[model samples]
Target: MQARTVFITGASRGIGAALARGLAADGHRVALAARDGDALVELAAETGGLAVPLDVTDGAALPAAVAAAEAALGPIEVLINNAGVSGSAPLARTDDALWARTLAVNLEAPFRLCRAVVPGMVERGFGRVIFIASNAGLTGYAYTSAYCASKHGVIGLCRALAVELARSGVTVNAICPGFVDTPMAQAAVDTIARTTGRDPAQARQALERLSPQRRLIEPAEVVHAVRSLLPEAARGINGHALALDGGQTLY
Candidate 1:
């Protein structure tokens, strides 16, 4: 792949950081964004990318962040909407605050960033918009009504924008991964351990078992999926939710 300016959110750690490193290694100039300024700076230094400390849910800050990224690198050719949060709660306990916050980070933030960047992409006649959504987006889960709803909305947004931009040379797609090995996954394991009095190992194994492979998906695996979408050959694969879940959900 030719070198391109890539902007990635939630790049401080986990899959975002992994993607930043992978893209940089593949000769792309990357702009890393996340709330953790220190981690972002460290990763940027390691990858020789620009670090833009940002909270994606902050609507006012997004444009400035994109501008700073463009100033440091160039017009973003690949926009990776990877910043997200996860929570699990019963429907009766899913209050308005939880629903709104989940939707804001998981769905609305990506919408805002896509709105900010897609115009330039359409003008340039080439761009890639990839959202790191969850398997919950494709199917429902118990005790996660808000998270499921938000991810479903994200997939919806991806399809809607993909069709709108179909002839504009911009492909919008979502990568739905199941239980990746990240700090977020570890935190979920800890929560399960605390709630069910299971050993940390047991809790983690239980979560891993959700996949037919009976393991946590690695960050490198997710990075590979992102890399696959960067080439000209992938232009035909627009508006699709590519699942990386080891056949956990066969939709």
Candidate 2:
């Protein structure tokens, strides 16, 4: 693939950072966005990409961030909405604030980003949008009502944009991964350990067992999926919530 301007949210660490490095290695001019300004600057220096410190939940900041990225790198041809928040709570305990925040970060932010980027892509006759969703979007979990609802909303938005942009040379898709070996996953493990009186390792293993492969997914796997969807060769792969889980949602 030829070098294109790529913008990734949550690019400071974990899957988003991994994707930024992978795409940069593939010769794309990248614009990295996240709340971690220090990490973003470091990664930007390392990858030779622009760092735009952004909090995705701040709706007012989205346009300026996109403009800055476009000014520095170029019109964003690839958008990776990887910034997300996960909250695990039973339906009864899931308060309004958690529900609102989960939806804001995981769903509404992506929608806003897509709105900000897709028009230019349409005019340029090319674009790719990838949502870093979760398997919770595909299947219900015991104590993840808000998380599931947010991810499900993301998939819905992805499909809607994919269809709307189908003829305009842009493709929108969601990559729903199961529990991955990221800081977020580690936090979940820590939470389980704190609440259930299990060792951290045991808590982690419980997550791993969610996938039949019995292991947490590596960030590289998600990077590969995003890379696959970005190229012209994968043009037909639109409007689909591509599951990155190891058959966790196969049923």
Per-prediction TM-score: 0.98, 0.98
Model 1 lDDT tens row, 169-194: 99999999999999999989999999
Evaluate model 2: give its lDDT.
Answer: 0.92
| Candidate 2 lDDT tens digits, 1-251 | 88999999999999989998999999999999999999999999999999999999888999999999999888999999999988888889999999999999998899999889999999999999889998899988888888998999989998888888899999999999998899999999999999999998899988888888888899999999888987789999998898888898975
- The total number of steric clashes, by the backbone 3 Å criterion, in model 1 comes to 0
**What pairs collide in candidate 1?**
none
